[model samples]
Structure formats: C-alpha cells, structure tokens
Target: MLGRGSMLVSSLFPLGVSGRRAGVLALLVWALVACRRAPEVSSDEVGEESSPAVLTIDAMDNEQHVLRGGFSVEAGVFRVELYEGSVLLGEALLEEGRWSIPWQPGVGSEFLEVVAYAMAGTEIRTRLDFQRLSFTEPEGLYAAEALLALPTEPDITTRYTLDGTAPGPSSPVYTTPLVLLNKRGQPAPLSLIPTNPDTSPETWRWKPPATPPVLATVVRLQRFSGETPVGPAEARTYLIGQGATSLPVLSLVTDAEHFFGHDQGIYVPGRMHDPSPEGTAGWGTGNYMQDGKEWERPVHVEWFEETGAPVFAQNAGVRIHGSGSAALPQKSLRLYAKEDYGPESFQADFFPGHPLRDFKRLLVRTSGQDQQNSKLKDCVLQGLLRETRLALQACRPTVVFLNGEYWGLHEVRERYDEYSLASHHGLNRKKVVILEGDGLLDTGEAEDAIPYAELLAYVREHDLSVPEHFAHVEARIDVEDFIDYHVAQLYFGNEDWPENNIKFWRHRGGSATPGAGDGRWRWLMYDLDAAFARGAEANSLGRLLRDERMAEPFVVLFRGLMTSPGFRERFVARFHWHLDNTFAPERVLARLDATVELLAPEMPQHIARWRYPESEASWRDEVQRLRDTLARRPEVMRRLLQEELGSP
Candidate 1:
C-alpha cells in the first residue's frame, strides 16, 4: 500500500537554550544594579549558585522546530527584557505566568538574553536560567528534482536547486547531478536511472527496492471472543512490511483510525467497499452532482474498486469447514503467540512533516481538470471571512480548508457583500482561521506542468487570508485539523463539473479567461490535435485546482461551491470548445475524454478493467447528449471545439 516515497522518522537536532542562559545572567546583573529596589533575593533560596535559566534547542525534525520549554513564575508586575548584543529589542510582561517567543534568525548566528525583576511590594521568587537553540532545514537542502521521460529523449542538463534558475553547464560543477525516469518510462537505452538509492544517515539515498518485498511476516498474536476472550478463539493476524507487496486492491477507504496500515494503516482490499456495491463512490448524499435526481448506484470505477484498496492476510489457522457454514468444531486459541513483524516501524503513504494529522476540522477539496492556469481558487478560499467566524464559534480556535487556488485573503470582504455563503458575520472583523495550501500547483511548476504567471501573482498578494498556498498545517495557530481530498479524482472529465466547481467555490460571478492565443502555436502547451500537430501531456486532476486563475469575486463563490461534494461546476467553455472543433462521435465525449486524461497517466496499467458495461453506458449516454446538442445548432460541437481546443 505504501507508494513511491516512504516516511521514515529519520533523525533530530539539538535544542539550544543559550538564550535562557543570557536572560538569567542579565536579571542577576539588574538585581545587583538596583540596590534599593532589590527585594531580598538570595541565590541560595532557589538552590542555585547564582546562575540564570539555561535554554538549549535541538531539531529532531525540521517541521517541529519551536519548543515550549522555559519555566514561568507566579503572576507579577515584572518587566522582562530581552537582548541579543547591544540591541535592546523588546520587553514582555509576566501577567499570566507564561512567556513565549518564536525564533527567527537574521543574518548570522544569534544569541538571546532576558532580564527579569519584580515590581513594588512584590518580592523576587525563583528564576529560570539560560537556554541554547540551533536551527536547520534538512529537507529543504535534500529536496531533489527528477525529470519525467519524454517521447523524444529530453536533452539532459546539470543544474542545482529548484529556485526558478535555468540549467547550467554539466561541467565546471563540483557536484554530481542526477537524472531520473520512472520504471514504466525506462526504455532500453536510458535504463540507468536511480530506481532505488541507499539512504543512510550521512547521505540518505531513497531508491525503490530491486526485488519484490517480503510483506509483513504473518504473526498470530492474542485472540478474541465477543470482543474479549475468556479463552482463545481467533488469533490477531497481520502482515509486516519487508520489501513490497503486489496484492489485488479490492477497494479502499480513508479515516484517522488506520494509518494506511503501518500502524493500523488503511490500505487493503476487501477493506475498501462501496457499501451498496452500487452505492456512491464518495461520501455524502448521493445527488451531489446531478440536479434533480440522486444517483441510485455509485458510479462503478475500475481502479477505485480494483487496485485502490488493501488486502490483509488474516487469521489463517482458523480452519473453515468445507461447504457448510452452520457450525464448526471450535478450539481454544493460542494466547501467547506474539509474532514480531521484523521492525517496530514500517511505511505508510505519509508525507514528511505530514498534514491531515488533525482530521476533525474542515477538509475541503477541488475538482477542476487544471483547465485554468491561476491560483484564483486558492485565494478565494483564503478570502473566506465567515469561515473563520464559524470555526471560532464552534469553540475551535481557527478554521482550515484544503487551499484550492493561489491567492490572498482580501476577497472575503471584497466579494462577500454581493455573494456571501456565510450567514452570521458582520463587516470589518473575522476570525483568523489558518490557511495551509496543499493541493495542486501551490508554487512554481515543472516539466509538462509549467505554473502560469497569473498563479504567481495571486500567490504573491499579502492582503489575502492565507499568507502562502504551498504549505499545509505546521504552526499552532494554523488549522486545528488537516485533511486531504481522497476523492479528488472525481472532479475530472465531468462535462462541466470542473468549471462548475470553480464557479461554485468562487461565488460564480466572474467570467473565465479565454485560453485562446491564436492557433499558430498548435502544439505549444497542451495536447491539442491541430492540423499542424497533436499532443497529450500528463494533464490530470492536479491541474484542475491550479486552473482557478479567473478574475476575482467569481473565483470566490467558485471556491466555496467546490468545497462541497456535489461538484456542480460545469465547464461550458471546454464543452463548447470541443463542439466547435468538429469532434467526431468518439471525440465529442468531453466527460470521457477528460476522465481519460485524468486517469490515463496514473492508471495506464488498469485501463483494461475500466471497460465495464456501466462505463460504456455512461459514455454512450454522454455521447448521445453531445450529438443531440450539436444536432440542434450549426455544427455546435465541431465549431466550438475547433476554435477553443485549437487555440493556444
């Protein structure tokens, strides 16, 4: 169940408390200086040898840097002063017996000092000492870029960093540059790509295993009967991870209970169920998209049902009587058969500095086909003022959302007067819900997916609610809960769903930008099949959320609407564009084409199973709808498709 990247606890840095050291020392000096004001404070009272509080900082991980360490005294009207060198930067009050400050280094190495003293009528009590802290960004330095293979072998280049810098000469560089191609893309000529790299402490090399992994070693541990057992009945069964397993994925579901199977992780077949077999593919009331009618049976998808779920090797010793199920010879279970799964730690699809740890708050998702090329959707979400209020009212400190586009928090006030989905909030003030952008192109682009310049602008705006769109929860005041869009793939290829989704989230008033740049550069970006050339890149659902770069307020409600599961946004332009392009009976299916576009790259191996009767039925129904719509106007489908799809 663990995919490409594996999550390892990996390593830690020292907690530096030097600042505390300086603070305590300064306070001693101050007490000595104020001879008359000094209130009988002796070093022997606190059982210390006139030493100040000491502070030390260590980073076990880059994400969890800040630490809550110092000891606080009783509430007193005392002035606590802090200094680095000659700079008398700031002072704080000891009001509620708590003091906290974030560490942000400027220029070179930093040393902090704190001075504390009591007010009139109050005597000095025990004081805290010095602290030492160190800071570093391991992941930042280790992050490497990989190149996906091209139909025509891409010219290899050597460069360092992903900071929008162009590739430089492979020579004159002291470091060895690495290039990569996926297992599927490994042709005979360029098969030297790193599949598996040995990752150790000094130099971590992350490479896929060369041979099949010995999945979890089966171990029978404990037994259960009626939730508890006087005796033994069935032993607990589990498969540990050694290498990797290639099991048929029956179905899959997500929840906080299982950590994707590593520690009660959630990825196994038979575990993933549609509930009704014909039930909805996702959560919520079934009529999420279709207007008047609710779907009786959930759309049957192949990958979702086949290779998406997990499979477990369960209670193997429980001998099943052949044929009959009425009764069986029950035996006592082996109570103390605890089998070790090799290692205490294993792998799940966990992200480094993972989000979604707090799964209770709001977990929203987007479903565009990356048709648009801006971060408007992200900004529109950050602009939600009422959301902050609602979250605060629920007793939750701050609100959170799966950031869709790449913009700031200004639009909440700008657009709400006209189309506010939120009810109980006045102007001028809103709660500060933490916004962490996780999905799609949160930042710059790469390869076939080049981030549009428009996305960069929306991301740059500081007046917006979210400061940035490329991050998820890491700060305390940030979102309380962090969740991901498990069913994000549903947004693709649904006639106008992607458009409708953006429209709904954005409040739907603004118009979409025309993606046309004349038909001259036919094979420029997307896979347009013009008379000049034909192309299809790895366009998927990710590009869907990235396409929210519409003009303001429109992107507002559009973001909010898509936060829901209904997915009502429709792509009128793309639908019309396809029609104008003289799309044949087969090519007229935008829904099908879009679905194919989204699923094809990731699901090339499973496309054969997608040819079920239900899928064909959906295709035919959509095809007829297209044909009949076109039959009504002047080559409606053809003209529109040719005009838009053919444009740059």
Candidate 2:
C-alpha cells in the first residue's frame, strides 16, 4: 500500500502509503510537485508530438539472450530498453514491426520492466510506452540453501534489510544474490528465581526473555525510482540448515518498533502501563492489553512444514490474543488476512485431509493456562475429542519466531469465529450467531442473543422433568451436541468451565436450510488448559452435580435435564460410549505419548526461553501426571455417575 510518490530518494521503500500535509511545507510542496510534472523535453528538440510509440514484451527466453517483443508505430524509429532495478538488462532498436533485445534475465529474477523512447534528429523525442513482466517460483520450506535475486533498471535501485524491518533509503543496496544460512545455535539458559521450586505455577508471572536472536533469516526489500518507490515491498523467510522436526514452524517478521516502541508497540509495557503494587500477582494493565484496530500491527507470516518445506508466505495483520495470556512473556497472537494487509484469506491447505483449508484467522498460542505445565495438554486433550459432534479448534503444534527472534514453542490453531463456523458446517458466516457464557453474543448482531436468552429463561422456569418440556428444549438446541460437549469437558475435568469458557452457535436462517440451519444450537470446545489440573481421582462429575458456584443458566439447565429419565438415559449412554472409545486408556495414552514425542526435541529451547516448567524434569512429571489422570478418570467418572443417577 505504500505509494510511489512518497518513496525515499536513496532506494526503494515498501508501499502502503499514508502521509499528512504540513501547513508550513504546503506551498513549497505544491511548487516542487508542479515542477516535477513539467515535461523533460521541449517542442523545439522533438519537432512536434504526433503519434505515441507502443512497447510490448512478447517472451523472455531463460537460456538465450533473445528478449522478443513488438512495437506499435511502424513509421517512426524507436529504441527499447529493458531493466531490472537501476541495472540495464538489455537494449535494441525496433526492426520492421517487432524488436529483440540482446539480454538474458538473472537466474532468480522475479520481475522486470521495459520502456520505449522515440528519437528525432539525435534528440530524444518523448518517453512513450512501458510494460512489466513478472514470474512466480515454487515457494515452500527449504533445507539446504536459498538464493534471491531482484531485477535492476537504470533509474530504479533496490534496498533490503535482513532484520525483518521495512527497507528504507539507508538500507543495504541489493548488489548480488542474497544468501541465507542456517545458524540455529543452542538454547539459552533458564531465567528463574529460587522461590517456587516444585513446578512453575501458572499464577507466577515473569518478564520477557532477553534470549539470543532467531536463527532464521527474514529478507525484506523494495525498489525505488529516484525518491519514489516502484511497488510494494516484498519479503521472504529462509530456514537454511535448521533440521527437520515433527511439528510445523511459523516465522513472523515485523519491524522492531512495532513491537517495542514506547508509543505504538503492542508487545511491551508502554506509556499506558499501570502496574500492580509490588509483591502482588496481577497481569497489570499495559499497552499490550489494549485491543481493537489501533493495537493491531502489520506482520509477515511464513509457514513451513515439518520437513522444512514452505507452505505459504504472506503479509497479514496481527494482534495480541487472549485475556490474561496477552500479558505473558510468550504471548499468543491472532493473525488476520484482511484486504488491507494482503489476502482476504490464507489460501493454502494448512491441515492436510481436513475439509477446511483456507483460514480467515489463526492463533499462535503459547499453551494458554498450561504454559507453565505440560504445554501440550490443551492440544492433546482436544485431539482426543476430534470425533465428537461439538465444534473444536484444530490444534497444530509449531515453533515460532518474531522479528527474527526465537519465540519458542507455540501452537498454530484455528480460531473460533463466524468464519470458522461457516467453513466447518457449510453455513453462511453472516447468518451465524455465536454466544459465549450466559447470553453474551460472540458473533452476529446484538439481537442474536435473544434466542439463547429465551432458551435459558424457559429451562430456568419450566420443569424439564416433563417430557414436553424436555422436548421443547431439544427443539431449540442440538441436545446430542450439547451432551457430547459437556461429557468431554467433564471427562477432561476442565475446572475452568460451566461458568467461563462457554461457547455455542446457531445459524440465523434456522430451519430454513439443513444441517447448521436447522435453528438448533451447537456447542464449541475450547480452552481446556485447566483440564486434568487436579489429580486422576478428581471427581468432576460430583462437582458439577452438586457445585453451587457455577453460573445460574448452566446449573439450572444441567440439573433440570437430569430430572427426566429420558434425558438422563441419553446423557449416561453418551458419557459411557465416549469413555469406552474417546477416553479409552490406550487410545488416550498413545495420543499423549505422540504429542510429547513431537514436543520433546524443542522443549529444552522453549523451557530455557520462557523458564516455564523450570526444567525438563518438571515437564516430564506433568506429562506423567496427565497420563495417570487419563488412566484412572474413566473408572472414577463411571462410579461418580452411578452415585448420582444409579446404573446406566
């Protein structure tokens, strides 16, 4: 979006142009702009302007120095010049009706421009037509080496930066093929205090690590004509020599100012910071806690497969994600693909075999509440319920980098929003209504909360023990979907639920269409970081059945539904079916082991960077604890369920 007119004279500056006029410089700017518009040639030198010359580039041979093209005017003699960026690639005179230049493009040249000039009595008559040629190469992950080349022209020069900052006038000029090397070194040491020694408590907070910079090379460059930039700045990230891992890798590059600047930075405690009193534990208010459009920053996103093959490279908008997690040293980031940034959606098959490929938004999560415990807990727990009818975020573990700094292990997950609902259930995004907790609408219009409110009121007032009353509730929501959702949460023992982290969605068109449009609400499963927090013998079923601290609507509906034998029968049947299958000890353990194995290689570095678990030993203990919890949960849950409603 940077405009060519605002380009700095020294070299290319990336586009996305926005500027304000200064009152004092307005007159001087107008005079200079008027002069710049004046013709460089006079009437006496070029005789008289008649017909304009047309230039076209037909084909560019990769192996030969034959650039073939055509010209529009056959009567007047004209000469054509081909350029890459201040580098004259080739030149030739027009012959008959066509022209050929004796030049070959560079090995990796991605773009080139051509211009034709008319001639009369040895003086240049007028600058005529111009054309450009572009090429796209197969881009993905790379292991060995990657070479990048930029086209050159006589008046245009290209400047580049390797630190992820936007190229400016003073940036290094692109002289030769830029080479990227793998320099991934050992992980940094743990930064910790001696007080809490057991396992790093999730309540304990810390400052951002001053670890070493990221090893991957992020190259950003732009071309300039005089003081004006030719086009938008381009960027690429190369992961040379970095060995393969079982998980994917994401490289996010942006200017350091965007993250650490006092006035505009989104990652730092800036001018707006209001810290809590000393010795007290609080996330504290800071610029990072701010939300909405102004806090969103521009970033370049690059996704690499497990084998170091590239997936997709694009420019996107990024914002600090989550409520309390945003204040963490290793915070979560929400990536957006808006038209203002670049693409409307990330056009790639990020998750293979999954029906949905293109994602409107994604989250680079730092394991949320489990960041200090086993980082793989949430993702692994979600994986166990993949076969359930509830809508769950797709979780994929990945290593991440920010502004060429190794940000440690993070999960690239699908975000819960209207777009995701549309993609997953084939519903119109505009017609979807998602509500969280009681009756708060997460998506759709304010009026969308009405249906959920009505359902909550009817369940709270009427007796669901009556067959007609229970049947009415079923008509308003996907009863089976709701059961599966609560069952999974209960099985996981997610202590953060019932009152918080609740989400349900329904299509507005309701009953007008099939599937999602049946006007029946469905639940979403997310934020299970608090799951399995208690030991294996924790009685989650008993807690939900007798606990009074839960939200009114959730408590009333659940307890009311249990009053009916029909509803109780179905809930008990579904819960046991999941225990026999989804929570099967072997199946759950196999998934846990596989997830741990995937993260084992990167844990040392992530631990050192965040000092989360304090040591690899602590992390392993937590993983073992999780394994033990899964092993005993089914039996304990079954016994608890029997005590509440007798034998199934």
Candidate 3:
C-alpha cells in the first residue's frame, strides 16, 4: 500500500492480517505486499434484480462526469464482480478474492451493469454495493450546496458535522444549525437538538471514540438526521453550553450514504479573491487557520452551512458528524502535495487519476499554540494538517505550492504575517493553499529546518499552518542537493509508488531556496537532483554505479560535461569504486536490471543521433520523440540492461 509519498489503500493491512497475501521471493528484492480484503456483500446491499449482488444505482439514476473510477472492496472477502453489461472499468484484479473496478464511464444514462464476482475456494459470484449518481449543475451555480440536495432514498440519511466521526441516530447532540469546523478547519453551519432535552436530556450525552481522531477533540461535534428535538433550541443550547466544558475529544458521525458520500464540511462561494485563467486561485484574507495558532487579534468566526469551523473549547469535544453504514475510510477524504522536485526529469511521477480525491470532507489545519494542547499543535504543524487537506482535495489538481529557498529566517516571518492576513479574509481551505515549510524541504539540515521550526512555532503561537509563500520566497536559494532530488523524483516519477531504493528521502526536512517554486523546471532537475543525492551514500545510486537507464542518457551527458578524457576515466573509476567499495559488483550488476530496459531502445536513438550528418537526430523533436517512444515501450528497458551488461 505504501508509495513514494504515502501508502496505497491495499497496503494498509499487515501481511499476517490474513494468511492469504503471504509469500516471499528468494532474490529478496521484493515488490510490495498489497492488502486486499474481499467483502461478502449481500445482493440486497447492491439492489440486484435477482441475485444477491445487484445494481444499486443505474445509469439513469446516477450521473457521473467520468465513467471510470477505482473502488475498494471490504478487506479480505474477495468479492467477485459479475458483469452482465457495460464495462466496470480498468484492470480488475482479484487479490484475496475481492473484485475492484477502476472507474470507467459509458454514456450519461446507459445500461451499465455490474455484479460482485470474486474467487473463493473455486467459487465465483457477482457482488456490488452502492451505486453512483450523475449530477449536472445548472448555469452560474457557484456553490456546492446549490447542486447537492438531501438524498431522497429514505434508507439514505445525510447530516453535516465536521468533526471526523461516523453517523448514527441521536448524533445531533447540538442545537439545529450546528457550527463546527469542517475539514478545511472552516466553520460549517450545521447543528441539531433534541426536541425535549430538559426531559430527555440524557440522550444528548453522546461521546467520541478514542484513537487517531479524525479531527481536534475540542473542535469535535456530532450530528445526524432524525426527528427534530421537541424542546426549545435555547434549552439544548444551555445543555450544550454546560457540556462543552467537560466533553471528551469530539468525533462527528454523519449519514454519508444519503449524500452521494459528499462533503460533510463547509463550502463557500465568492470567498475567493484571486482567480486566474490557469485555474489557479490566489487566497487572500479570511482564509481559515488550523487552530489556536491563529492571529492574536481574535478573528471573527462565521459558519456557512456547506462548510465552517468547529467551536474550540479545551476539554470539550469539537463536533461529530457520523456517516451511516456506508461510511468509507476517513483517509479517502484528505489531501497532500507531491509538488516541487529537482529537474532530473521534466515529467511528474505520481499515481494517475489523482491520489487525494473524492473527498467528502475538508477541514482546516489548526493554526497556532492555542491548539487545545501542545501535542495537537505538533501534529498539526508537522504533517497531519497538510496531509489531511491534500487527501480531501483529490482531483486533477494544479496548485501553487510555496517552493524555492528558506528566504532566510526573517523573511519567513514576513511571509507568515501575510498568511495571517489571508486567514482573516474568510477564504475556504480548498482554494489558495500553502504547502508548509517542512513539506517543501527534504533534508534535516539546519538551514532548511530552522525556518520551518519558526513557521511551526508561529502557527502554534498564532494557530495557522500556512506560511507566506510569497514572503518566504525571500529566504533565497538554499536548496539542499538531497532536497532537490526528492523534489525531482516526485516531479519525474509520474506515480508516487513506494520506492525501494536504499536512500529514500522524505520532504519533512528543512528550509530551501525560496524562489525555487514549482514553476521553475530547470531548478527541479539540477538543483533538486543534487539535493536528493546530498544524503545518499553507500549503495545508493551515484555517478559510478550507473543503472542502465541512468547510464544510457547519462553517457551522452557525462561525455558532454566531462572537461577532458580524464574526466570520463575518473567518473568510470568512481563508479567501479562504488561497486568495489560497497556492493558485490556481480550482485550489484544483477540487481541493476531495471535500468537496462530504459537504455536499450535509446541506444539506437543515441546511435542515430551520433551518426546524424551533423545534428540531425540530436534535434529536440527527435530526442523528445525517442523519449516518448521509450516511455511507451518501457519493456524495451529490459533489452537496454541485457544488451549493455551482457549478463544474459
């Protein structure tokens, strides 16, 4: 489940979670152990016509923009998909017996058929669960709530509570129009109350579950759909006022099944100040801050129904909106940044089809120190804030990430101040976002780290996760070579799959050159590559031990860059030294096979370019075409290593 940036869904379970996905290869150079649990879904759950597995939502019923999407079945059961008509989408694998169909769309309201079909003990059956909905918004509709209506299926129940929790009856523990922070940490306007709290007041005594809480405990609140409370809203308000002083950490459970599993957080239109043709928007003032780190000026808090902020009260749970039976993993509704990399490669390496997508929740990260507790502040500043937001904004994203240098110590402070200004403006978290200082850096160096520490401290003192990208840019160019490489890998890999290399650099490091924003392509290759290699040593890929993929293109570049023939020899000598010094040459040679496939076909391109009357094949178009061809027939990579090394 782990990828270069985060773990995949299937990788969540331990191998021993079940004996089914266990085994090992002798070479010991293993791939990943994907966790898959097959759920034995009943036909009624899927709303089938005859069998146990049925089509819950038909084409006409559910309108979706795209036909293709990935799905996660219940862990371990290996539910099989029995398709009667219409494609279920991408490569459907049957690991551990559950069927997962990638999203594939056919016409608007076509007769798309799907059934649960998995393999178990030689038996296969069709299985399916919730169906999908196709929604088309009317012209000029600018807000989320405009198009999102309460789900009509009585079996479906939808309630909005920003606290990260599941749904249930009596979950509406607050007065109607509950105001709690949504995922973006913005206040969502939603509250519920019991009809007769004075008489049946004990019913409002709901509590939250303990563990990696979905949201801040003090910010937690719970709500749901059911009979409205009979008592006065003020009576319940008094109860809420009293309970807020001593409630446990909050968890909100909501009936997500009724709402197309949509956002249980806040949504605001016209809250954005800057919008560009690039689809990138600039977040000015009034944007939500994570928590107590917010500006000391005591900013005003507003609760919009579609989105909002949780009422922060120490010792009291925030708010909880419990999702009904169909609740998906909370992880699905978060967001993150895989932006900023070295220029080693121009292309980005990330899982296609968006990673942090289909989020039904968005909460703002806690800002500064008033964050309920010190531990909570660290979690918010360190990562929990950034990752959670990234998980929620999952889509074909084009974001403006704060890249470049540490801009120096004082500069970050200036930028942080601007960040404060943006928060007071009421900008929702989704638009005009900032990648924190740590997330942008990759090395544990003092230069890179100190600025982030300052940023984090400021957030704690002020309670905001966002630093001023524009201001921090003044920190200037201080890209760690290692930082550059990770930024580069993240840029080139195209998919953030788990990396098995000896040196795996993560971005929670330090300050960097501020101006080195995501826009600077050249900075990504050379600067980032060096940053990535900064910490690399012993067995890590380097100049001397070139993988074929690295060698092919590199040979040309190496030759091009070498000041003299001795330079080439010195390079080769260093490479051999890596083999001789660290790894067994033969073993290293054998293991370095993935490189071969990359270079094989490119050899001809190189030869053709070399043989070109002058610069014929060396032309940019030709080089690009060659690269594209290689990318398409990447298996040609195998030929590269074999032919170059001759181990076969």
Which candidate number would show the highest TM-score if scored against the true structure?
2
Q: Over the full model, what C-alpha lDDT does candidate 2 score relative to the true structure? A: 0.72
The TM-score of predicted model 2 comes to 0.75
Model 1: runs farther than 4 Å from truth? Answer: 1-349, 353-356, 360-499, 503-648
Candidate 1 global TM-score = 0.18
lDDT of 3 at 446: 39
Per-candidate TM equals 0.18, 0.75, 0.19
Candidate 1 achieves a global lDDT of 0.22
In candidate 2, what are the lDDT values of residues 1-648, reduced to their tens digit?
A: 112222221133234321222212332343454467656886677887666555655443322446666665533333456676557665665566667776543455544567654322121222212222121353555544434565567878988787678988777776655534354542322222121212223555564454554466667878987667777777776655556656788988888777777678787666666343211245565667789999999988888888776778888999988876666666788999999878889877677666888999999998886898898888898888888767878888898876555678999889999898888877788998889888798899999999888888888889988999999998887888889988998898888887888888889867655467798888889898899778777788888888877767777777878888898899999999998999999999999999898899888878877778768999999999888888999998899788877865
Tens-place lDDT per residue, model 1, 4-69, is 110110011123422445345434444444564446857767664543433312111111222222
lDDT of 2 at 222: 80
Q: Quote the lDDT for 39 in model 3.
A: 54
Steric clashes per prediction: 121, 19, 196
Where's the lowest-lDDT run of ten residues in candidate 1? Answer: 400-409
**Global Cα RMSD, each model:** 30.5, 19.7, 27.7
